[model samples]
Target: MTREAPRKRILLLTDIPPCSNLTAGIVTAQMCRFLPKDELAIFCVMNPHLRPMLCDDLAGIEMKTVRKPTELQRRVLRGIRVGRAGAAAIEAMKRIALPRRLIRQAIAYGRAVGATDLWAILQGQTMVRIAAPVARGLGVPLRVHVWDPLRWWLDAHGVDPVNRRLDLALFDRTLQQAASCAAASIPMARHYEETYGVPSTAVIASIDPALAQAPPPKLISDDSVVIGMVGQFYASEEWAQLVTALKIAKWRVGERKVVLMTFGHERPPNDVPDEHLRFMGWMDQPEVIRTLAEHCDIAYCPYPFAERMAEVSRLSFPSKVPTYLAAGRPILFHGPSYSAPYAYLNERGAAYLCRDLYPSAVYNGLAHLIEDSTLYEATALAARGAFLADFTLPRMERAVRRFLGYEGGKAGQAHGLEVV
Candidate 1:
């Protein structure tokens, strides 16, 4: 009898807590689902905080948690100075020591799971550092998923100068050591090539087939046109701009009420009129998909026009666009044209894009979409077509499979691996 080949083991190292509502977690779950189960064994890191939500059934997979050695100390310190100073101190320690701790724990977990054939790290400067040494030690290939450009995201999010510098250095070194890298967008791939001299494949996060296969129930209201958005609103300026644009659209569509329906956890600006906005709080994926399909007449995907956003926009794509497109609603892309979603969707006639970073541009785009039913239908159809052609789960899975060198049969299994 022919003997079966040994299954290659893959370790998925991520900063994200699995089974959460976060985009990275969802993407990681999909990656787990589509990878060749017969040829590969999957292992993932579980954040302690997400243990309660760990009910997602990932059969035949192994999971490990690396609790920080300093977690108790950090908690005690936090208890002592449970305010700004304490927070600053803990952040400093995390920046300085977290990478090493994560790496050590990852090594321990890797050994427990037997020899690993490859290391798969989700985007983050610290995660890259944690995975790189393991891959090098095991003589195995490492794959880094570039969800966002780490350097720019850190800078944009107000990371301290010292930590930012250290993280960037480590990030650069990690990429140099990586066997391959996958980016969320083509522009991101090109940026990696130009900036680090490392070629990358674009493996964009895409929509699940279950979510994309059906059209939402049509619930049109004669009195109001509901414009919906889902996800965290990280930038206040962007939210403020959106409110201003909504006001403008309200005026243009005289007598027709405009409602901004939002889903997810965030505090809306007090300045924006409460009557115009409806906060749905947080909902699960199924509810979100249902609301998008049945309730919304228009979908809004906004990126901030802040310096950090403009910088990172050239290097990453938003995971939310596929969801917005799958809703089969007219989409208003509010952000710089350079961003991947705006650029690609606008080029494909899938959305009405506001290239200029002004509320007037938003006003004009909204007015054009709201007033012309023919244009609205055409744009909606284009978005659905684009989602099917480029942003569906099957399409993404095929691309990722090719990138991982998992062609037909159990070919190109990683070799020369050693237990930690």
Candidate 2:
């Protein structure tokens, strides 16, 4: 009897693209980078708006839209009949319940496309609950990647205590069903194990080396200092504190200014001192990277010091760190010392850690770095070296392959590195 051919089909279930530079998009892009483009038949189930973004160059991968009621449609239709509160309740129900329909559609698509493996990258708990039986029926392994439980929890609850409880229960149930699980960091992996009794592998979000090659530095005065922060600008109490710190820093430092490059919908307060604060509006990925490379002198990773933020710090690795590292710049991380990146930076001597969110500490740290050119360059070089060694695309690909039990004997040969 002839042996059956190895299955080459994969089903990737994720949110649609183009609106935000989320961790999900980053991981999906990384998967595209390493997965054998020619051999594997890929099918993506994503939001309708994201269809145009996943073009032909993605190794002939096919995309199918996961149809659901749009938020506006739901509000208009339900609010017209029912009260706004009732409509909102209905929308919440839909959010929790829609994944089942989405998964059924995914299963049908997978079977149609002859998929042998089911991979889920978003809606973790819901995806696991819905995809488990489908994978079992199809006799395929189910792989689930968890990036941030806090984000997922907040998304599910949104300040509703009852919904928060329901979300946690669902999250636990879904986590229990995953055949293989991956987390974004070591701390996250530990949290998964501790909370859900499931083993998970650490896989940080990766950067394409080609993209990591630095762009031409932006033109600025040699003596002018610019501290930069990038990514979303969701309003939070910590953000208010960040503004206060920046104000204090501006007062202390004569020539330096703080620049926030964001894709956030909300604008910074108009009254923020013009001399100290510069808000560069929404930038595309290339532009963001170029801005970071050319203009930034110090990278700020500031988040609120709250329970939810602490959970985020533990469970989610920051993608911006690699981007900053790639820019060959020093990072001023303002958060808990126990965070994974904080530990990593301390180990490498690449970041300055602050114990408190006080303005004085923030001011002092920024002042010292601005004055000490030797310290700044040394930290920058250390950060860049760390990225090249452990956080690049190739490193991530090998980790994913190992977690999938596909590590080859010659896998480390190209890098002249040994498998741990």
Candidate 3:
């Protein structure tokens, strides 16, 4: 009797535990889920510690948690302490020797599991240097996943310009060595092609429709309109502007409160009084969806319109937009025209987009959404339709598999492949 062919194995190196509801983690887990299970085996490696609230979906997949500095790394440090290595040598030992040691570990793990491919999924520059050596040593294809413009992001967040420049140079060199690179969006792919001259395949971060059911539609008879936002509250200037607009909206509506409901890492600013804002810090996916459906009439997407932010807007789509759409609500987006969300929503007439980037523009947009019921309903329908048609898990799965060089029947191709 003929023996069946063994499935190809792929080792995915990522930031944290897969499907931990973190943006990149969710995409990574979904990619693994969608790959042809009969043809490929997925193994994942995450550093430090895994999330306690890890997703229970990935059964039978091998997961390894790497504590920084393996046994070899510790031995090298011990040798340095014992005068066998000098102070200058310590930096090289930690930087060079440590990754090589980890590479050996990765090779052993890959061999044990019969992995034929090494994928270095990078959320940022943190793992690029280490992953490069690991992929090189394995003599297998290295697929690099680029999520954002890391150099621009660091520069925007106030990293030293010189250091950012240096890091950008290093990341470029690392990317050049990859067998293939996948971008998070088409704009991101264009950005990489222009800046780094590497042709990138676009594989957007998408939501799984089957993972959780959308909450029942909440009745909207209340006097107040609650505006909901999920994810980090990064741009305080924009937040202040949004709060100011909502206050104006409240006054115009009379006896109706304009509430800002937020979830995730940061809390609403101390200045945005308790009456105007409700902060629920760090909610899981289900809770976030339930809260949005029950309390929020409109979803808020805010982007700061600075030069750095303009660059950011052009390179990547906001992760929260898909989540907001899946909740089946109209979006009140405040961003530049170049941003992927703004461009998409504006083109599709799916959001009340405020492109002018001022308090007056945002106030007018919010007022329009609150006062016009017909417009609100239409926008909400469009948003949800967009999500179902193009941004669902099944569509994302096909896009990812195609980008990764999978060949098979085109069962999901009608939804369209978005590789740029």
Candidate 4:
């Protein structure tokens, strides 16, 4: 007779704990759904100072938080006056010794809870180093959630090139052995799957249904067309092009006006003319979605088109897609042909897409939205369809659950993986 399998208990090791104040934490909370309280635990490293940022998102179940090794080491080094060699020695020693403590603590907790699975959240370096060794010691299948560009992430965190190469190698090995993998976007998942021949699922953390409702119809000004953008601003030149297009779309004796309204940022836009711009600085997300639905005629999404951003463009899907889709706004994509957002919207004919950076090209796309009512309705409908089809919290949760245990998960073997 076959022996019965043990119940699955997960131990998540991460540098960013699950909290509502940050995007990574919010996404992690979604992954926690459909699991029993006692079955999942979090062992995370966060700056104690950011404790105020913690919310009730993870109020129950088991959790532990520790300061990063570098944080602790820096505090120690400040207390003593050491020569360069001595300082380097002390720092290296602490780095080695502290990770040992983390490893021991992680293994102990895993054993205490009879953990059947090990999960790692890769936002930075420490967890990547710590989780793999601990998983090896625990004899459990390792599940990896990769949400950031690895090289970009490392570089952002001040990792030098030589060490970045070493860390990348370790990351590859860890990914190689993982029972399953999840990426932040479809392009990222495809790249990892092709490179490592491992099953990887694309999981975009999307809004709840309450936030996905279509905006109530409203009476827009007959002469004004409102275009809205939400979330963090990154591509400055692209935004300038948007402002320039708005200016260009003006004139022609009683032609309808085009207005650019933006939310979720506090900084004043650069050289925006008074007649064409509205900046609502940092509204709450629900309100932002509501505003997008009720008021805006079109939603704008852009990505950098420079050669330096090629990898990022190809791999990282814009998080704003879901927001725009959910709000039933027709997405106005301004980016290179190779970007993830461009490929996604272009493939479905779901948006008024512009491939060039010129103000005239951008204005033409805007004019299509302003002049063609059919284009607006059709594009919005297609975007909403994409949202319902792929981008939603429930869909994301299902993909993660399937990858975690539903199908190919076993106690020891991790070779054969099936995509959900």
> RMSD to the native, candidate 3?
6.1
Q: Which stretches of candidate 1 lie over 4 Å from their true place?
A: 1-6, 36-52, 68-98, 197-199, 213-219, 248-252, 270-274, 408-420
Q: Write the per-residue lDDT of candidate 3 for residues 1-420, one digit (tens) a residue.
A: 998544566777665556665766766666776654443443344544445346686655676656553212122344346332443344344456556666677777767666667777665444654677777767777777877767655554343444446557778887777667788777777667676666577787677675333432432656787888888665566767877765655434545677778888678773666777788888767567767876788888988687756666777777788888888788899888878777788877779998877778888888788777788888888887877876776777666776665657652432232232
Q: What's the lDDT for all of these models?
A: 0.67, 0.62, 0.68, 0.73
Candidate that beats the other on lDDT, 3 or 4, i.e. the better one: 4
Q: Candidate 4 residues 1-420, lDDT tens each? A: 998767778898888777655656656775675465567888887755664355464567688777876532222355776654564465456546777888888888888878888888766666767878899889998888887667666655555445567668878887888888888778988998888777898878776665775632332567677888876666667887877666554532136766678876355466666666688776656777888888888898878776766777888887778888888888889899988889889877678999998888777887777667777778887877787777766666567777677655422212122223
Clashes of each: 0, 1, 0, 0
lDDT digits (tens) for residues 131-228 of candidate 2: 56567666787777776763544553342444446656756766676666778888887778787776678888666565564422322445466777
Those runs of model 3 whose alpha carbons end farther than 4 Å from true positions after fitting are 1-6, 36-52, 68-98, 156-163, 193-199, 210-219, 247-255, 410-420
Candidate 1 local distance difference test against the native: 0.67
Clashing pairs in 2: 218-294
RMSD of each: 5.7, 4.6, 6.1, 5.7
TM-score of model 3 relative to the true fold? 0.81
Point out the worst 10-residue segment of candidate 2 by lDDT: 410-419
| Poorest stretch of ten by lDDT in candidate 3 | 69-78
Total clashes in model 4, counting residue pairs 3 or more apart in sequence or in different chains = 0
Q: Estimated TM-score per prediction?
A: 0.84, 0.81, 0.81, 0.83
Could you give candidate 1's per-residue lDDT for residues 1-420 as a string of tens digits?
998755566666665544547667777666666654443444454445543344265544676655432222122353475454554466567766776766666676666666445546555445655677777666667777777777765655455556567778888877776667778898877777677776578888776555763433332776677888888776566667768776656533545788788887675663556787778887776677678778788888887677756757777777777788777776888887677777898778988988776778776787787777788878888878888888776667666665555547532222211111
